[model samples]
Target: MTYDAVTEQDPLGMRGIEFIEYLSPHPDDLGAVFTRLGFRLVARHRSRAVSLYRQGDMNIIINADDIALSSRTVQDEGDQISAIAIRVANANQAYHHCIQQGAWAVPTRADVMELKIPGIRGPGDSTLYLVDHQHKVSIYDVDFEYVSDDHNPPALIGGLKFFGVVQYINPESTAEWIRFHARMMGFRALPPQTRFGILPQGTILQSPHGHFYLQLIEPVGDALFDAEWYEQLARLAFGTPDVPATVRILRERGVSFEDNEFAHPDTQGAVTAGLSFGINFEIVRCPATPESP
Candidate 1:
């Protein structure tokens, strides 16, 4: 029997997100902000100044090493999304597939990582790492040493999942990005009516795996010509069964949310106050993901 379009179009064997990495000089400060969002310091890289934070199924890496910033694509000075690791069937195959499809290859450095993970350049100064997870070895076991014995750190807000990321694109690049994702990763652009979270003003691309989304948002009218506007991964969004309850618990944990027209705690979703590095978290009104029968 033939499979559906999503399965038939998935050339890279894309699974789901493994981890999102951030490049921050002041990792301690970033860690504090993450802690406020209920992430616990779980692991530290064996060879680099990178610490892994975890909450539920989400994994975040904070890379603070100068060597890492120098060798890889760290063009900007401020803290931003450096890389996002995507689990695939075969890291080598996935990496080569992207390169064959006109994707820019990021050279693998033996000194930086124990596992020779292959990757390509993504939007802004970010790389998308293709990891061969559980093919033979788990990437974490090879690269990280557990600092916290708690393997499964429950989120403060129950049923939280790494829903997706919000990417700010340069003006008039929304369609360009949509086509890029469709061609490269088998992502389908949902109908315009399809939306998630409080600030719903963008094109949403659904992954072939149906595990996450990538919302591409272009600059607004005034910011369209703003000299400072640049394309970058802007926000990390999580999905929960209840939005107000999630907001309340996070508030008790000392997390302050932006109470403005764009975002509020009482809405279907709430956007957390941004950190100094421009990173923000959005809690959407998506239900607890259903399990297969």
Candidate 2:
């Protein structure tokens, strides 16, 4: 199959993050945290220990399957983001394009009851899935069974949209990671002075489509670099039209925010204290764009 060459000007037509998958031994605990953050469980996997949650256009998957692909890591880490599925114009083309540009192809071994999605190995043991845009059908439709009759679309709280995902890397791996995304995934790094949300000390890369971003952060102040601190998809950020309003809604739902000197609820942004399994979220006040709808 032919593949497009990744370049600063030309990309593989990646649209946005399709869904973020979290691996957890205690799905209920993580599910509660998700509910507090305004997500509702909508579907359960047909043959695996997994469930799907939805809010607005965002999809979150909780995988508790002992036999799942990343089960061992989940067992070790308690709960962490294990995979990120990206929406693309064509999954095969995008996968091939990345492979040609030096990405390591993740082997597919779908069971009889599952659909094989194309992907590549990402930082650490995380997998980056490539999925085609499907209007009438979804990959979830094939692997998951709907548990809710509410056919209505998910509602957003204060107009929230995916801003980006933060990745924690080794101290000196910033340039290497930047080059990987730039050469293989068509990501362009932002200037050093440019910052986002409460945490501002990371290298940010904008996707080719400009729908979302990827932030690469390194450990600070003589922190020991262990295998655990090498590279991992750390946190996910959501953009809101009003930070205070969004914080209020989440607070009413039992979510707590950090109120310290460095990061607090304000017109700029707010961050939640680390929830169960070291998962935290950021709420940033950004003007709602037409593409967000």
Candidate 3:
């Protein structure tokens, strides 16, 4: 399917989401949460207090950067999503194109022999990094040391794959973020009916590359949200061919999912119970491949 570039040139050459970075002053605490979700500690950052966790095609990085954590979206909100690295054809081109579209460029720091991935400020204090890691040495090879030689670990659940990211926005600001993604990134706004997972009130922005989506949701009804609500990347969602099977496997592994009427596990989708500080995972059902035995 050809991507809708919306008149503006998509210099990012967006491939898909390469990795999602989570920032925590006490980074050690997130390991167990990720492990319960089937991620394995596969690498350690060569210089910084960062570690990489992997599961199938997903790569998650935990950064213990106190400076980054201090600017978190809301007061008292701990362990926030710091950055999302988009795989691009050229990092410099991607960064410049985003800046031209009014995105704030994030200052980068690279020590001796370290690779500096270009990035831009995102919704809140979060950063959006652009990495060009095609065929040549992987960005990981330059920055992280392997904790496991097995690069291709099979997914613990039924081919668990990245579905999208959820962003909580202010009321009636959906169109603003929609235009931002359309002009800055090559994402197109899907029809209102196009939705995934159980939490249904949101706008879905589809990436031109891979199975990627960005969901923008705002509080509705008499929801009891913290009055200190600020825009931020809310949670990560995964696409699985078999939602029921994935839920069953994860439940056996001690990952508790929501069982209420709104988010109970079914053949269509399922959502995991929130880890402290608002870490949640949503699993959406996708079509199975013909090659599956």
Tens-place lDDT per residue, model 3, 169-244, is 8888998999988888878888899767787878888876445789998877654366756788878888988888
lDDT of 1 by residue, 1-293 (tens): 11222244776667678899988888998999889888999899888899999988789999998877775443666778888888776777777778877889887765655877888988987888987654676677788899866866887677777788888898788888887777777788989998888788889998765667899988888987787677888788888878888888888888889997656776578888856566778888874334211
Candidate 2 local lDDT, residue 233: 87
- In candidate 2, how many clashes are counted? 0
lDDT to native, each model: 0.79, 0.80, 0.79
Better of 1 and 2 by TM-score: 2
**C-alpha positional error of residue 20 in candidate 2 after TM-score superposition, expressed in Å:** 0.5
Task: Write out the backbone clash pairs for model 3.
Answer: none
Model 3 Cα shift for residue 275 (angstroms): 2.4
Candidate 2's residue-wise lDDT over 202-274, tens digit each? Answer: 8889876566788898888755535456578878899887888889988888889999877788887889986
Ten consecutive residues with minimal summed lDDT in candidate 2?
1-10
Task: At residue 41, give the lDDT of candidate 3.
Answer: 90
TM per candidate: 0.90, 0.90, 0.90
